[model samples]
Target: MSGRQGAAISRDGTFDAFDLCARRATLEGIVDATTLPRMADGVADEGGLARVAWRIEGTSDALGRPALEIGLDGIVPLECQRCLAPFEGPVAQRTLLLLARDERELARLDGEAEHEVVLASVPLDALELVEDELLLTLPFAPRCERPECVGAATAAGAAEERTSAFGALAGLKPAPKNE
Candidate 1:
């Protein structure tokens, strides 16, 4: 949880809904994904901030017949697949996340399935969701900016070895014929 930080959710599970009701919302808190419900290192040199945003349509769940939507945007450092260098990039996505309280309510949410949104029994840890998405977005191999990278060095070495092998074969030729 090094350099970990994020907003606090009240015990009653309420935050200012209005604050995040704009076309875009900027949350200032380091949501230490290490502190999320379930998390692990899928690859090496993985870590950083996972900022989130909520684009509410109607209102918070506390409001009767309330309907809301959320969107997430942030960046995390990921190791490059090609060169194994670290790079910071965006992790942005928009989806429907339900805040319903029971399975019955969750099923009802499915009625709005065309929305492709999420239905949850509890208040979602917004930061955690963003963190997980960002982690999953990481590339399989990390590459560096330098054209002549560590991988290139290895390639050069392999080419030299092949050339030496060919030189040995050239020496085993038949003798020249005379008139």
Candidate 2:
């Protein structure tokens, strides 16, 4: 593991995938959540600061294909869809990406469906890859699963106790048949 910690990787920095794999190099760093614009859009508030730690290593997959293993862990503030409240959610993900040498090879590997296949575009944007993985890990509809949140939702629902809009229509009866 390389000691390239504390925002060592710039947003535009690129890495040669082939060389990294050959050397089996590992890079790890920390990035501010605010720096990731796309990820900020998914969170509840952009004002709060969050730190995301990431690690990437170049190696070979079980099938002997060049690959990159990525790991990310962080906490992000998210809005609860159930109670409409803000809460902190944990994010952790690990993925193995197989690299294909060319477009033709990418298409062929994509059909396997057993592993994630990506084009080994020389000088790959490492920061962009980290951001992409973070976005993918976010919940589509974030909901606070805590017991307090659940209780609050139940209490609010009971307090409102709204009658159904079609309740009056249910009371109507069919008209008697004309003689």
My TM-score estimates for the predictions, one after another, are 0.44, 0.79
Assess candidate 2 and give its TM-score to the true structure.
0.79
Give the per-residue Cα lDDT of candidate 1 at 53: 39
Model 2 residue 134 CA deviation (Å) reads 0.8
Kindly report which residue stretches of model 1 are placed more than 4 angstroms away from their true locations once superposed. Answer: 1-8, 11-28, 32-65, 111-113, 116-123, 132-179
Give lDDT: candidate 2, residue 152. 88
The list of candidate 2 runs beyond 4 A from truth reads 1-11, 152-179
Q: Write the per-residue lDDT of candidate 2 for residues 1-179, one digit (tens) a residue.
A: 35443233345777777767877777777787667878766777743766789887888999888998988888878888887788888878998888989999999989988878778776777777888888888888889888988898888877666444345555576767899
Worst 10 residues of 1 by lDDT: 1-10
Model 1, span 76-178: residue lDDT tens: 4556665666666455665444445567876777787654334444455455555555455555454545666766868988999999999989888876888
Considering every candidate listed, which one attains the maximal TM-score?
2
Error of 2 at 26 (Å): 1.0
RMSD of candidates 1 onward, in order: 10.6, 4.4
